[model samples]
Target: MDLRIEQAGDRPAIAEVHRSGFGGEHGRTVADLVDALRRDDPGALSLVAVEKREVVGHIMFSRSLLDAPRRLVEVVSLSPLAVRPAWQGRGIGTALVREGLRRVGERGVPLVFLEGDPAYYSRLGFVAAGGEGFRKPSLRIPDVAFQVVRLPAAEPWMTGTFVYSQTFWDYDCVGLR
Candidate 1:
């Protein structure tokens, strides 16, 4: 398997990965969310996992804001990570995430946030953001689901509300309804 930055030609396969992973309407919604993020978020970082020249997994980190007491700080939100069903148990998703985090951190992003299962993300170095002085943008997101990972660039004073890009809100993907 090969891990690399996503290219234009990878979009269709990426969408398929999400659709296959999520299924039905939610799958399509997540797929569309990926397109919107790529189009609207200039700072978005996307990565793909390929095997046999086919995309098997994808992960994205899009620009978000942290309304810190001192000032608003730039951060990222990891969302819609998907691995092809056939590739699910092979660590493709983990590789995408590890690589995505490394690439985003290299860009000087202080923190990466996501709404996901605690059991899954905790293994990826994420912790409950609420307990660390960060607030979720919506109450719909459970406290346990709102997770965050701090990079070397993060500062002790950078704690605050994590705001997702408008596209997330526009697509109604911020949290569970």
Candidate 2:
């Protein structure tokens, strides 16, 4: 499989991948979230995994913030990771995530946050973000699903209420606001 940055004209395939990977109404929501994010968050970093020239997986990281008392600290939020069902269990998702994080870190993003299964993201170095100095913006998010990974450039001021982009709420991200 090939892992690389998403290019123009990848929307249709990407949407299909997300829809199929997730399935049901939840899958449709995720696909719409991807579409909304692309239009609303210009700074988002998107990556795709391709096999035999067909897109099979996708991952996106978009600018978010830590709303600290004195200032807003810029961070990245990893969301909507998707791999075609037929392509699942073949490391396509892993390749997309590894490469996406690597690229975001290279861009000097100090923190990456996500709402996901601890067992799944922990393998990628994501840790619970609920301890002292960290906060989630809403009770909508499950305390356990909120995780964070501090990149090499993380700063002391990076702790605060994690705020995701409007796209997250607009898409109803599993009903978490």
Candidate 3:
């Protein structure tokens, strides 16, 4: 498959991809997508993978804060990663994640967080953020679900409630307002 990944500007397409990937009652909407793209952090990256001009996968990241003891540090949050069912497990999702991390890393940002399976995210160098000073993205979810990665020269910083933007609330993230 000739797969190419790029920064996603097509919000409607991304919403469609997410709804298809999750197959849940809470479907994605253009409003949620617009809020995502327009967030304070807007993510370290928003990526879409295309095969033959059709988007088969989509991933978005945005800025959030890692409230540490002394200061608030910038954190890139990986969320709502989606891949069309037919294209999943074929490395499209992995490609998006690896590339997203690469792009974020190049920007000199030091921390990244996500609420997901450790087994999966650990494959991408993400580990429990608690040790380094960032809590799970929400209090309603199990703590184990959140993880973080700190880049070179940054200390394993803090552990507190992650302060994601209002966009996360609008998008129906696990459990907080």
Candidate 4:
């Protein structure tokens, strides 16, 4: 498998991968937020895994923050990961995520956060690492989905409600009441 993960440069392909991988609406979530960021704070890091010029899988990082001091940090939130059904389980998504985290860590981002299956991310060095926001805000699901991975060490007290990128306000996080 000649799988290579790198910065995503194609727009149409990105949309396609998002739609197919994540299924239904917001496949173009990053594109929308990217446009919004052009307004000033572009809050997002987009990555793509390509196989022979075809974007088989994709991932996106957008700005999210600690509810306490309002500090800005990128979060591994929108995992619009899609590798054609035929390619599922071939480690394409894993490659996309591992590379994405490495890049995020190398840039001194301090930490990476996500809402996903602990069974999956925990193996990647991420743990349930945060406090119960004064208000779990409606976006949080089952309390356990909020997870974090600190790189190069960060202030141990980094805790608070996490506000997803502005674009998040545009969608009703699935299953969130």
Clashing pairs in 3: 41-63, 43-61, 43-62, 132-158, 133-158, 133-159, 134-158
Off by over 4 Å in 2: 174-177
Root-mean-square deviation of candidate 4: 3.6
Provide the RMSD of all predictions against the true structure, rounded to 1 decimal. 0.7, 1.5, 2.9, 3.6
Model 2 / residue 159 / CA error / Å: 0.6
Best by TM-score: 1
Model 4 TM-score (2 dp): 0.76
After superposing candidate 4, which stretches have Cα over 4 Å from the reference? 1-9, 26-43, 69-78, 130-136, 174-177
Q: Over the stretch 1-177, how does candidate 4's per-residue lDDT look in tens digits?
A: 444434435666666665666555554554454445434344456677777777777666655665556564444453444665656888887777787777767766666777778887878876775452222335446667667777774555555655665555664443244
Q: For each candidate, what is the lDDT?
A: 0.93, 0.86, 0.70, 0.60
Candidates sorted by lDDT, descending order?
1, 2, 3, 4
Which digits, one per residue and each the tens of the lDDT, describe model 2 over residues 62-155? Answer: 9888897778889989998999998899878878878988999999998998888888888988888996467886788898888899898888
Q: Which residue window of length 10 is worst by lDDT in model 3?
A: 1-10
Backbone clashes in model 1, listed as residue pairs: none
Model 1 misplacement above 4 A: none
In the range 1-177, model 1's lDDT, one tens digit per residue, is 899989999999999999999999999999999999999986688889989999999999998999999999999999979998988989888888899999998899999999999998899999999999999999999999999999999999999999999999989998896
Q: Which of candidates 2 and 3 reaches a greater lDDT?
A: 2
Please rank every candidate by TM-score, starting with the best.
Answer: 1, 2, 3, 4
Q: Lowest summed lDDT over 10 consecutive residues: which window, candidate 1?
A: 41-50
What are the TM-scores, per candidate, against the unseen true structure? 0.98, 0.94, 0.83, 0.76
